[model samples]
Target chain A: MLSEFDLIKRYFTRERAGRASTVLGVGDDCALLAPTPGMQLAVSTDMLVEDRHFFAGADPRKLGHKCLAVNLSDLAAMGARPLAFTLALALPQADADWLAGFSEGLFALADEYGCELIGGDTTRGPLNICITVFGEIEPGHALRRDAARDGDDIWISGTLGDARLALAGYRNEAWLDAASHEQAGARMHTPTPRVALGRLLAEQKLARAALDISDGLIGDLSHILAASRVGATLDVDALPAGLALQREDQALRRRFTLAGGDDYELCFTAAPAQRAAIEDAGRASATPVTRVGRIEAAPGLRLVDAHGVPLALSLRGWDHFQQ
Target chain B: MLSEFDLIKRYFTRERAGRASTVLGVGDDCALLAPTPGMQLAVSTDMLVEDRHFFAGADPRKLGHKCLAVNLSDLAAMGARPLAFTLALALPQADADWLAGFSEGLFALADEYGCELIGGDTTRGPLNICITVFGEIEPGHALRRDAARDGDDIWISGTLGDARLALAGYRNEAWLDAASHEQAGARMHTPTPRVALGRLLAEQKLARAALDISDGLIGDLSHILAASRVGATLDVDALPAGLALQREDQALRRRFTLAGGDDYELCFTAAPAQRAAIEDAGRASATPVTRVGRIEAAPGLRLVDAHGVPLALSLRGWDHFQQ
Candidate 1:
């Protein structure tokens, strides 16, 4: 029988990029990291479990990428640059091929984002992956939820609804051929964390409030409203959807855009005067930015039609622990 | 149904004691930390799963304490003062009483060590808890495994075999009266991490190599020897067993002391010249330290009995994914 030590040495242990932030990594009881001087270290952890987070036969490569990508999205929400991450994994068994593909996907994205894997633990149990990521941001420059003002323009980066649309296709609620299914499924399985845009927001002092839309736009926007003590009026017709989703039934597309979740795009607020600067930022990061709404003094979220009448909402986003 | 957000607000969220190192605590995408000048951040993660790490019906209070204790023990091995920790938890159901008890145990230990609960994730799944801890240590002062040298005296802190005895009693393989059972069971359930001794080792530059004895002395010592490219000579008679265990059969006592685990004590190597200072550290920390053997230049472990005759062994310590 191959031992756990051999499994780690063969699968988890690899040559690091010699990141200056990582002083010591792996092997020891604890890995050592040196946070950049005068910068605060931002840390967050997210866990994914089999069946709950994904189907049993989901691709190991995509699963691994999604696990780390979601955590990186959290760092993006806080406008922090990627530093390092630790992964704690539980597996039913050590499948060498599965581990190889998983590591390939994990390291690919990590290398692209300049985030190094520093330390982690692997054990025998039902499949579970928990990643804790570290990033850095200057003091008091973080794009906080409580910082949004009454007149700030609410903005979103990249298109929405694709991941949810893909999920709908997977469950057979929508029709799609092989290529279309693959496109949408890819969105659901592999999310590109908006790291560059987030850094731009922090460095250029663009956003007053920001977060990635993981839960549906409505539920997540409520967080900012509650934190900032403000309300919002979203232009329903202006909501951006993936090209495939936009061509679907308008009502279904609207539901996917408004209430469907799993999108890892940054939604943020900035003063109305910074619209041109927002465009420059979007261009600089090569990500699309859409004006979705405006922060208001009212206390409740209102979805306005073209004539400005509010629409009623009955659908809810996914919530953990809601059985 | 209680939402994950509501659960975090109701249970996990709390006011933090203002530590200069913690710039931001919970209630955000990520927590922010500030490492002290010129100090490296030491990080480690450990995961515990139901039925694998502990019995299914184990008390949640002690389980919580053990969860954090095990991770803190990793920091103790590195001689780091714990700064903060993140708890990623999965629960089958939200039992309020269980959560209350678990939080109580977690907070009590965190408060004692000044290690704050910073941030983490909560989700519905099979029972699991993963804790990632961060602490600080100065450069070039960390007690590393590769630093052990020939002639270094091998030292053990606190008593061993009690936890193993508790396990034997639980399995009905050994006879322990009620009082004795509880005594040994407490050792298994609430092993006190030797944090002070590790810090003393780093500060005083006494230990050449160090690690906690979670996987039995023989197995964990091999980790040091392999990393250092050295070997060890153990004086089997000098190995310490708890008073209760010592009263058992001599062979049973030796096996438990040698092969049994879950002893969160320090197994470290130090120069024989530091004997006086080692004693002073022990008195100052009020923790017993015992000289068990010496590091050898040869490439394998040798265990000698009272008359210096070598004993042979074939058993190995627990490995999570042996298959």
Candidate 2:
């Protein structure tokens, strides 16, 4: 096999040097790029490990897509437009087929979002993928979680709980008879970052607080609440549980809906006066926006049933340090 | 043990939100930061894996410092001022003592540079560290390897060969006379990023082309040649071979000088007219800047003896994908 240097030269460095933005690229101590005038770069990183983040036999294409998508999700949360990303992939050995599939999936999503694969490092080790994505936003205009206030309406994009149900049993191959199941599987493998929606919100000045739902809806939404110094009462009935959750038992359904992660949906807040315009914007964009809760004067998260009664839960959601 | 969520809250988030250029930090889907006004952000990433990059039993403090330092070295290459960084750490399990030691070492260097730990992700896996550092530089003024002109003077900071020799088993742990070996070991473990010198060079507008020496002087210098579409001839007699190479055989010394990878010193090119000012700046800053060679009109790298004869090498330096 060719050594690492030769491999990078052959495969990764095959692209031509582009414009002035990249002053220097691959084969240096670091890649140097000139940021555009009046733009602030948004930076985020995520790490995925074999057997811990995904199964050993998981498809490389899915893995690659998810890695970039997760990082993009972070950019979206910050109201940043995707620009370029660097991948740091650690593997046991070079597997050509795996690399082909992985690159195809990664580039496909990157192309769709107009993100460039500017630089990366590939090394030999147990499989671990760390991706750091860079996006650009106008200076001082990125969305922040600390700006929300009491009496703001909490909104979520698309349905929840389906990703959790799929993770429980459906391995992206199995599907239930629902249009959203295909999307849920796709979300599990290759989440579509809410980039456009984020841009729309930023341009319209609608969202007071925003975050992408990577952890379960409640857990992730709680982050905004804590940061905003407010509380929320999520109306469980208003949640769009997708299709998979509809087939589960009551306890399982509630568990999946409340604590399942990997959704990649956007949970944001806006003032009540702006809700109509925000809903109209979502409709015009063909993106689903559901009002699931409201920010409250209190300072801790609470859940209310359709009848306005509290429900109990044994666990919150997936925690990374927990086994 | 606390679950991963609690662990992150306790250890990672407990620190006061760092203030370098952060607009919003932690607690959100992504941390948001704005580059300093009139400055562009310089970004770089690096990954370290168990056994491949460092021994499994290596000190956590040293390992953590090395990981962040390497990325900072990239920022140094671009003549950027260190501002913030994100760390992605994958581990088989949580070890409180290891985490504490690692954070101590990392925070020490970060505090010294005024670089803030802004955001990151941690997960379960074999020990792997990926750190992405961000810095600020004047727009369009960042140093790059592609700008070296044909007649530029080549310069390197500090001595070479020690890191390679230390890795090659030329060390005495107990002997007080072996201070150079101890220094080499320290260099291998906790390299100090040349951030201040980089900033100085940028502010003074001295360097024509610049990069950090991570993959040996020869290999890395070759990159400058390749990128700038020029060649170079090094005077072996004038090369700074460090104390570790002083007692070695000529062939072994040559090998050490040619292929040592962990030096983390700055290698740069400057116009002949700027040499006096460059030396003056280096002296003013107490940074040893030595003239090693000159960029040539030809398009291939060549190492010459005192008599200007080419030397052969079995291998250049460490390649990430090479075994």
Candidate 3:
């Protein structure tokens, strides 16, 4: 096996160091970045652990991509333009194949989003991937949960319930059709970050509050309501259910949509007057902007069906500590 | 026990939310940071794991401080002014007392350096702490390890080997005076990042290359040499040995200085003409800068005694993966 230094130099440093807004990149004590003038940097961190976040036999490439994508989702929630990131990786052993695939996936997404991998530390330990992403947004314009008002519309991008269904063995060889299996697996593995839509929302000053749906839509959306000191009434019929719900009963579909996590979709609130503009922007960008809910005057989350009847849920969403 | 959200809001968010540079802090999907104009951002990350990096019973406050301090050392090596940081922590359980002490230590240092803990994520897993520190430097002037030249003078800030000595029980409770033990413990726990000295060096453009000594002076300085494509020769007698070596045999002292890690001091190279200026800056800042070696035309590290005899060692420093 290659020594740690050799491994880092051979694989990690061999890539062409992209020009950064920072003054320095790799081969430095720290990466120095120059934030664009009039912009505030958005920062978020996430950690993915083996077994806890993924299966032991999961593909390394997908692991890397998902780790970064989750952080990007956080930045997207704040309407921040991708800039750069740092990765902290701990592994049980050095696997050349794994490293290659992982780096390929990580750099591919980074290249797509124009976010450079700037600085990081690697260590030997149980498999853990921690990433901190930095992005930029104009001062005073970062989408925040506390900005949501009582009368704003709550919007979510992309279809819901697919990722949760994927997690429920619906994508397994025994349960899924070939095409459905492929689609579900892809959704589980390489969920796209809503960076473009986030940037557009920020540029247009459309979103009052925004966040990505990582925890179930209901659970995460509840966070916005709590932070804004307002209640919300989600229109269950307006939720964009995915292919996974095609064969499911209404009850199952509702459960899946309400409790699905890992969707990597943007959920934001907009003033009533701005809804038309937001829908237009989403249409132009080829991204869905479904108005699934509305902020209300009370202080707790509620779901209403097509007939305006309350839909009850005994559970909310994934809580890392609850289990 | 507080739920995850409540824990974050009550403990993590309260201290880091009010910093002037923070446009938006906790309770949002991401934190927004507005950098002061005329300053570039310095970014660095470090990860610590249970068993691998620390004992399970290690003091939470010390671990928190050391984790943040290690990243700060990276920023210091780049000659940056500390600004903010994001933390990703994984723990098996949430211990209220441990969390309180940990956050206290983190925020104490952060307040001292004017850095805010803008964002973080906590989850249930084996203990893993990953901190990414952000700092500011003058545009285009961050120090880097690839700038050393053949004729530069190598200098180190403060004394070395104390942290390793402390870890080995050499300066532990029974072996040292109370004051000495306290000082040694401080070295191992709350290391001071040489931020001011680094900033002064960068502002004056005095250093050609720089790095923080985390993996021993010899090993980390070798990094500078490798990056700069140059060699270095150290004067054995000029090494700044600390109280940890006061009563030790000369040979053991030399070994400690050579192979010891965890000394969060700055090792840098500067042209001979800049030596006086460096000393002046060090004196003004009350930080010692000692010229311990010189860069060479060759491309490998060498150690020489007073009579120019080479010192041989079986190992150079700590390698994270070495069994």
Among the numbered candidates, top lDDT falls to 1
TM-score of chain A of each: 0.97, 0.91, 0.95
Specify the CAPRI tier of model 1.
Answer: high
lDDT of 1 by residue, A294-316 (tens): 99999988898767888896667
lDDT string for model 3 (A87-125, tens) is 888888888999988988898888888888887888898
Model 2 vs. true fold: TM: 0.92
Q: How far is candidate 2 from the true structure (C-alpha RMSD, Å)?
A: 3.0
Candidate No. with top TM-score? 1
lDDT of 2 by residue, B247-286 (tens): 6777766776767888888999999999898888788767
B151-223 per-residue lDDT for model 1 (tens digits): 9999999888999999899899999988778888998998888888889988889898998888788889999
What are the lDDT figures for the candidates, one per model? Answer: 0.88, 0.78, 0.83
Give Cα distance to truth, residue B63, candidate 1, Å. 0.8
| Candidate 2 chain A lDDT trough over 10 residues, lowest sum | A171-180
Order the candidate numbers by lDDT, best to worst. Answer: 1, 3, 2
Give residue A268's error in model 2 in angstroms: 1.4
**Which scores better on TM-score, 1 or 3?**
1
